[model samples]
Target: MLNSCKLQSRNGSKPIVKQASFLTHANILLRCHRQAASRLGRCACIRAKLEQAEVATQKTKDEVVVERVSSTGGSRKAFAKAFTAILGLKLAKPEDLDPETLLNPPFPRYQVPGSDLAVQKLRPYFFNRTYTDTDVGYLAFFAAMHLVAVIGGPLTFSWEALEVCLAGYVLTGMLGISVSYHRQLSHKSFRCVKPLEYFLAYCGALAFEGDPVEWSKMHRWHHMHSDTTADRHSPRDGVWHSHMGWLFDESLNSTRRDANGNMKDSLSPPWFYKESPEFYSWLRATYMYHQIGQAAFFFALGGVPYLVWGFVIRVLLTMHMTWLVNSAVHIWGEQRYVSNDNSRNNWIVGLLVFGDGGFGVKLRIICQCRQHIPRHHNNHHAFEYSAAHGLEWWEIDMSYYFIRGLELLGLAWDVRRPSPSQLVAKRIPPSPSAGASR
Candidate 1:
């Protein structure tokens, strides 16, 4: 009964283990080098600003030496080049579209040369798409589920069923989506026991976004290509696409389209849940039976009421709340950290996704309401391993609290957080802080 949405997981660094694999160690070193390069880039930016200021006081021509990031691994270069061509852009690789170009304009915005057109040049928003069988299946499933949840749920609602729904929401949303999918799988923010990890992953699978592996791969891809033309769900792709349209295009390998809707390059590809033979083997083994078993358990507990509220209603709400992270958070919220992508720390979303849980008691008192729990999602995009999202104590993250609790209980360990220096490096300087804040 498991849908055919394929899944894949790249071999990631194990931040917890003392004697990690050589590849893991190498990845860590690479991350450190990248961070160092970013710091150096920031310094270069400051020097440029200072030179600009000095030009007013005394005219001098001393060019600052800005470092250009080296191209990625060699053998991969040919592969990347081909991939880039398929995506339709002339870029050699993905790194070519990095945020550093925001200052230097590595890939400059296209300019129409004196074309008497009202809109001179088009923004690089990818719109060319095709609705595949997968798309139709997803839409049909989603629509059917929503219909049942809407009409059947209210008709069968009872206080007992409401209690079950509330519990199911917390289980599927918090444990499944937030903790398992987001923190553990997607970001690798914390490491937990394998059994617990698998259990949480199973809970997440019930959310039906996809198997945990696929969900994590998609999310990781989002981070890697955030806000770029390659980013599958960036609002820049069009708000609707970011929210749901992108779901149909599970084949991440498709090339992007030109402004005229011509396909440029072919993206890479997707994986079936079995692609990850290790981490997600159990999920694949029991994908269908496990889900059916849960539904049966709910039905046995409270018949039609429990089945309607626990399964249908919970799935519908979870789907929307998850979608809002892609659409609403990006559009409505404010950015705390100066990340490259347009990711924001939506307080409203933070509250809904991860409840206040007594952590933001002061914010609650001041705001005169229960909401306003700070989830530094921007920081998540900035420092993937950071368990702590909020910069200060006031900005509470219940998700982090749970992770910390698990760590204390010995259920999890080696919770990764960004160092003070790492934070300072990414910090927006007061001079250009206002611009970065936007």
Candidate 2:
């Protein structure tokens, strides 16, 4: 019977139809299997590439660590040798020690041989003693301002003057220095319409910090080489040096300028400058005039009292508070992240400068009442590009809030922030005990 059925299938019967259907199904399965294998192969290749990239990234991180350790070890050795030579116990040559290491000793000691003070006071140790004309002008200008603020402030007093001082503090300090100069210009954390951006830059000019271009360049340099020898305002270079002494250091200006007196391309100008060079250049040239005009206006409005409080006192306060960010915040406060620098989340500096506070009932109440946002300085160092420096809810960032307000109003866009995953990746892992307790 089987032989008869096979013969019938060969002659095109129902058995033939069934046999053809089974063959077609087998061909389909084979094709499907081949497609699946191809997809698996592609997935495996992608996975391999990802693993390679991860390995490379990890290697780079390890290399950075090794380099840092090697640099630190070399600095320490140089310091030890220098100290021994200073004591006359060893005859180590000055040239043998790293020049930077000599200038910036690992530990604090009196009479550091190559320090700025030593260069100034000690015989035959000058590195950059010849101050530029620009340097002299800056010193004289700042001195005059300080003298006026100190002498005139107490002499002229009025309630209206105090109110004016407070208003200018908020306008120039918070809006100008923090928001416009630091976040917008230096970091480009967010973008606003040109008119608003220029207006903010004008306000920042009133703060008497450098023009937007110069200020942003210095700030960028600080971030790029933070706490290293290149940092313009690192606390490692002495508290006063970081606070205000750098302003008089003309060598820094020389380094950033080319033979033609143009800012080096490497230290590129900020977006605002690139967008409108003439405008910022004009501001740079006439920024002092703006301050003078402001003083005159205040004098006209309420005589000596307004001039003292609104211009002199306000400028002094703003200057010191902003300088403290470069000094106090780096020297004090809690380190929330490993940013490879001495940046800290200082409550006092934060409260005064950016309105950031810490974990306390009083602080929380004040933050809520005033809606004052705080700058988490450590977070900022860790993620320099992040628009919002306050990573945690308690780390209220007023500058970020102002940017957020602009964003909502369609005046700001392209606001940048680290993703949740990126934040997690950058965060330091908790210790075993802490993790267990949590």
Candidate 3:
């Protein structure tokens, strides 16, 4: 929102400091003269000039404040002052100012309290679409991929191609997206050596969800501001908005841009950026090209069948599953524990997402495959870094099994967990079958 004001200035022969001083004395004189002069005479002579001088002083003060701010690399506090001073009038002290003026103004903009950026944190206007050219390009790509997947997936159906599709799904969807992107990168749920870690992250990049760094930062932001206006994929924005609307919405991108532009004054610690290795950062920066190369390789190897199944179908399926966690899981299923956001556990979504299959007849046989993620997903929201999303005998998380298998092989280590006692302390309700199983 912008505020426009017009103020007339005098072509003064004196320095601003001297003019300000003269005006200050003139205001005092005007006040004294008002008592003696008739009301009509008093109004005619000095009222207009008095108001103009006051505007000039306020403008000069505003300029000095903004100069101080710009010299120091800028800050939210500095910008807030500049925003008010330049665009609108500041209210006087509580004793003198009208309460209404303080309550609201013709145009209002503010910096989010405690945010470090100098950019005004204007409230989100959901209807005011802010899509950029990049977002439109992504939409175009999505449409093209879907069209190919629909037409080619049927025409090129074969046992060999189906096998390829299922293998790629398990590798890219389960290990790449679920384990690498959601668990390791998003939550730091476990630690692995850099070589293995980056390799898995590369697999995630092949999933075409976005780059590793972008995924990690967005997830962190989601957790930090879940369900609020700042949350990138809050279900509160409606099912479509939470599921995929946020991907194209400029709200998330704008926040990230502001963060980068104001890093010097950012309140977020340096460790957030330093957590990822240089190689991973480089991959993330150029990940679009990497994905294009993957598509080209698939095309060269097996033609349209390979391209459709490997790139198009794989990406489409992975996107839906990932979106389910943000949308269906929040809207359906029971909330097991008190949480800050409306995250839930939908068994149907979990079964489809975390299950694995290598060879299935026409690939539809694996559609009903089960995974234990939904049984313990609430624990993920409660204990973010815990490797145990399902920390019980009946709660069977296939992803956890894979992580454990890797730990036993010494390929992955430092598997973080919250003890059963901690779960009880968090007031997590025990399952009805808990005692019977024990």
Candidate 4:
């Protein structure tokens, strides 16, 4: 039953599903070109000369990595083309998809638009805006531990003991998931060697969000559509929808294949998703198992407080905080490059999530326009795989610093930064100078 769908090649050469896998490789290579072309890291500062050139001018070998983002950009345009051709497929078309649609599905036929508009008015309230399940799961676990504490009365009293939870959560969640795993490993914002890369992925799993495959897949989708109706979790839709609500609801999740039945394996973690689902399963299960198993061991060896603060509360806080970036950063910060969507630069967010995981730093090089070209993360939403964020020097970004450290340690190589001329094209003229300054 290979019914050709909207995602399928209209001419039917091959399923676009096949094209999804190389998204990462394609993105990285394109980023390299953008950086090399810009010369952002060269010797200069602020408003570098913009070098506008066809990304194709680079050698084929170099350009081969960045693929043709659906000419439709995971939007309703892409969705419509698929929907009309496929009869029953419920792909939302561009016109059909608006920021308000999620909160009030006009098509569900709000018959009594006047009579209280029950569904539409109520829809926004319908979502769980407060601490989500993952949030609840986190807090509940900690509360349960507290109750257990009062019930069992463990004999341990020391504030220093509590510090382990702080250190561990900060180290792993910040360095591991946000920085190493999601940002560097999955996105390739900067380079890293196998050892560091593997460690990053490992700690990411320890965060217990899911597995690497799942995390990266969802992240790629976010970049693919960004603000459009198809965007998995866009704040533009609403704060509740963007936060963690998407994780619980299937509708907000990404569909792996296009109308063509092509799978998005390439966007998945290296080797784990592509070479062997079996290995990924093993990694996923093992990470889950030891996370629980180790806690029990710690309880037996160290005591219940170790388990309560170190495991339960720490996990609960860590996850929600990590997710806050998705829910908060994009919606709160100031937009330096005017790409689309609500993405912005929140300094507290960067501090909270390890320099906003390097995007800002990479952008700084791209936006300089003299020594560095602007990356314009707004441009990134337009084109996700490109590695620059288009931030300026006055703006501070930490993720890039850590990546640089990896390079210094020889744990990472092929570290790309923009050149001078390339920065120019990505630059925006200094306004009242209303952005973050490090």
Candidate 5:
């Protein structure tokens, strides 16, 4: 089922394809025809063949007229906005997409669950939210930090302390986001030792992005819905909307939380957080225990500095940089190889994000951008939920490295890699410095 988390307007560009009526024609099996025809229809797994088609326009016979107008002109700006908004909701050329073709994309191998399922409809909005004290507390925390950056400075305490905290933040970005959240929590890319897995998730919870299950669901949805109305965060969509828009929206988060937050039955084995009730229980207790621990530390320290830096400032920094992975990576970056939409292998953000949040692990040894999931991210928008993002020898994947280490120790298994043929097919030009690591 394609969950509609809803959308709203801001001052940025509108999504390229809006009405997305074509979305309605997908998974004919899941349409009103099926749902209305039967009270309870069962959809079981079965192999179905689909066709693949691509249109190449080399000569560029058709030309889209370009109108140059004053940047500050209201009508010119309004015209641009109106045109994109209309196209967003209108039907796209079937030639632009073959929804059926999505059943299989360029990954050649290793697809995530639900990647091949057809989406039949789209809702224009999400729901309402009931926030808690914790929500309010964090909201204020973020507001304060934003004010400080605007008024004071970065609130620099000490380089030594900042660097340590920065390294820890980098860990949260790399180990926490890549290992815990993206690969492990989101895609189940590999397995991990129990104690380490639980401990890592506990830290990720501190990052407070949201519950891991909810994050995974939306992310899985993002892969399935990339570059379309379905994508929760695509640069092709409105910039801010694709950036921090949905994450901060009460309705969207609330709807996602309701679906995924309390789901223990949703787990797939060896996927402990979803599979093992014990793991879930342990993490819940750990979450509560962490709060108590923070309070206790504040008691022991008896100072505002710890509360501000260790708690508030720390959380704020982690939250946005994690968001930067989704936003910054899409907007600014050097594309080692283009797949589709707008996903670049950002160098500064990679180092800033501590080696593509570990996605560039083994592949990082090659190019540091390929490897791991979201492979051929350009391709990902063109092909969602591809487990192997790197189709070339140079793309480094940091998360894969950790997973590989665990596999060597007999603590992890089922590490998924793109087939050798896929690598040979893309055949990205070789980088002279492929096996370098940061």
Candidate 6:
């Protein structure tokens, strides 16, 4: 009986030991599998990061190539060898240049206007007719002024009338539009004492572009979305659309809404307007009255001649010249910098509008206030914050000179400009030999 009991105990112990060994082997296998999975996950994460970095690098390389093509101009082969040597990118077949591609994509918040809009059709003889009551009034006023200028200008051709027209052109076109509305108000390139600032703004108002706040807002928007479909006055749309057709488009009266039905704050009122809302509001409300008052004063001062020459012809000339800045400059002109938009350094437009000294004109004449003006519209686009548009010494900018004069008088400060390093950084890289020489 004792031998039988011993045998049973031994058998049970053998099975128990085998079960314990099997459990140990299963745990070891599970741990190894988990570790292998962990390593694979780590490798995948690393690969993803590397791919992202490569994509970013490739995108940067593409942009550099595009900028090279834009800045250098001419056949792609002209810069292809230099570009490849510099960037180590394989040169592919050159693609045809598309101006639209050169421009930046529209702001994420911007909604493109539909093609079916009446403004796009642009009917002749002002017959498209989408004007609100206020727009109609504006159209009528502008029409009347234009008629008087065209009809009465030659009829009342006197040296005195011509002198008055030229004087008004200098005061309102140069001081008001270029110095005040453009450089000072729109760009905030320089600071002035409040009195001087207000005086400059009032001078701009006399040009009859719009109130200071509204004009600056529109200009800022232009810079923000230049050459894109969102641009308010891009020549890509049409020369006439950029020039004077935009003025009649009533859709430009207010800020555009986004997909969510919220007004886009991208074109919010300028800092000056936010700082002094009441003043700008009053200025906007009383803008038309100021023009009317000026007309009355001109009539009272020198009768019909003063009205035609000082107010009528002056406004007409200023309007067309300013419009040409939006039209001719973009269409013609040379591109000195690789800006996203198609802004050009149109010397002829600059001569007429900004009083830029024309070809072969002496610098002395520029300083004497004979042809004092702004030039280098592309430079303005390239360096938006710069108070000085004329980067080169010979490229005279009277607007910048005005700002400098104000600074000398202690009336302007905090004037902004591109440093030498910044200018070099933005410039297109020269050929390898030229770069080595530098």
Which candidate's lDDT is highest?
2
Candidate 5 stretches with Cα past 4 Å from truth are 1-141, 148-156, 251-271, 281-292, 295-306, 334-341, 357-396, 426-438
CA lDDT scores, all candidates in order: 0.62, 0.69, 0.62, 0.52, 0.48, 0.68
**Where does the lowest 10-residue lDDT sum fall in candidate 3?**
355-364
- TM-score per model over all chains: 0.61, 0.65, 0.62, 0.57, 0.53, 0.64
Per-residue accuracy of model 4 over 1-438 as CA lDDT, tens digit each: 345664354655454555765786799999998888677656233233223233323433332332222222232223334434454434332122233544555333332222221111212333433322233333434456557555543455347547867876776786777666666655666666655666777777767665676567667756655655556565554565566555433323333244454434334234334444454555654555657665786587558777766666667667766666676666554454445566655555555555442233435465653322222334334334333342455444455556667778877776666566655654456655343332
Residue-level error in angstroms, candidate 5, position 202: 1.5
Clashing pairs in 2: 356-374, 373-396, 373-398, 374-396, 374-397
Higher-lDDT candidate of 2 and 6: 2
For model 2, how does the per-residue alpha-carbon lDDT over 168-257 read when each residue is reduced to its tens digit?
998999899888888888898899998898899899989877567667877887777776656656666666677787766545533433
Candidate 1 lDDT by residue in tens digits, 9-61: 22222342544666788999999999999999999999999988887445222
Superposed model 2: Cα runs more than 4 Å off:
1-131, 252-265, 355-375, 430-438
User: What's the candidate order when arranged by decreasing TM-score?
Assistant: 2, 6, 3, 1, 4, 5
Quickly count the clashes in candidate 2.
Answer: 5
Q: What ranges in model 4 sit over 4 Å off?
A: 1-158, 251-272, 275-281, 357-396, 432-438
Question: What local lDDT does model 2 show for residue 227?
Answer: 67
lDDT of 5 at 219: 67
Candidate maximizing TM-score? 2
lDDT of 2 at 222: 75
Better of 2 and 3 by TM-score: 2
- How far off is residue 372 in model 1, in Å? 11
